[model samples]
Target: MYVLEILWIVLFRFAPLPRIWAVCLIAINLGALFFLDTTYGLVALLAALTGIAVMMVIYSRLGFVRLLGIGHVFWIPMLIWFAASLPDRQTDPALYWWVVVLIGFNTVSLVIDAADVVRYLRGERAPHYRWRAT
Candidate 1:
């Protein structure tokens, strides 16, 4: 699909920094899934999957930096739930650390997305990259 091609180019070609960041984020999400049945792991994985679904929809209609907030908006409340239920959630050291990293990493990403959305609303509407069929 053109959206996939465009997303690939947007992340890999036009934006090397974002590419590296995306890889790291993917690693974190996948790493967190190692304990899928424990300590909020299922919810975390769901959030990641849901975020991906939302991101794909947003990407279909807008550029990466523009409406990126919509892709990440669900994460904040999930983080809050993670924090509120931390002590009660059954977690070992590994799962605990994964949750911590997931919270920290996604919080930073949400902040970045918020800023990007603002920039977009301020007229930075041009897409960073576009893919054309060869």
Candidate 2:
């Protein structure tokens, strides 16, 4: 399940799809959070909000490269937290699946963002498409 979610995000990122489709995907992903355990779901939501806050701060103050670096840095501990929570799979399969899906998305996004940061550092001017672009 987690593997499929990761593949979906990676494929969607590169596919020539309309922006609305990406928005739909995000909506679906967020909607799925309701099925998760309350505590776990709230934690995930907070983490996401924190990530957004961090991105806005970094992007507004330091620019894109710094935003990417800070975002990836923030994700590292979240990744670790998800990994540490893997044992919950035995006790609560549903919550476990939710965490796995979140981990997959975060990991893929981090990788893509890291690649872009490296490209920028290397002086590459290749255009990158973001899902949120207008």
Candidate 3:
């Protein structure tokens, strides 16, 4: 559990990797059913994917990254869903660890991503975005 959280923090924080690549890896490796076997796991993965998909859709339509409340509008429901399903302490330690890993990773990543959006909205900086070839 400790190792998984540590790895999550490291991968999302310090790794010299693009955010999209990291998101893709997370969405597949952890978000996929094979890596998650608990009720909470399934819910979190589904919620995360849904939130991300919505964000992507908005980004595509709006052509800007800093829409007010957009980040919260997308993620708050998922956070609530995760909080509602927390397991009891007597649950298996292994499953508990998996939950922590997924929750911690998702929470930290969302916070970082939100900060970037806020900064963009504030005009402190421009949002980083990938250019698509037309």
**What local distance difference test score does each model get?**
0.73, 0.57, 0.54
Q: Compute the lDDT of residue 65 as modeled in candidate 1.
A: 48
Encode model 3's per-residue lDDT on 47-118: one tens digit a residue. Answer: 655655655565556543454225334445655665666556575665555555656665666676777667
TM-score per candidate, chains pooled: 0.80, 0.57, 0.56
**Which 10-residue span in candidate 1 carries the lowest summed lDDT?**
83-92
Winner of 1 and 3 under lDDT: 1
* lDDT against true structure, model 2: 0.57
The local distance difference test score of model 3 is 0.54
lDDT of 2 at 2: 29
- Against the true structure, candidate 3 reaches a TM-score of 0.56
| Regions of candidate 2 where Cα sits further than 4 Å from its true position | 1-39, 61-69, 124-134
Return the candidate ranking by TM-score, descending: 1, 2, 3
Candidate 3 runs further than 4 Å off: 1-32, 35-37, 62-77, 80-85, 88-90, 124-127, 132-134
Candidate 1, residues 1-134: lDDT per residue as tens digits? 64476457656675578888877877887885687777577777778778778877766777454775667788888899987766333537777777788888888888888998899889998766556423
Q: Deviation in angstroms for 103 in model 3?
A: 2.1
Count of clashing residue pairs in every prediction: 0, 0, 0
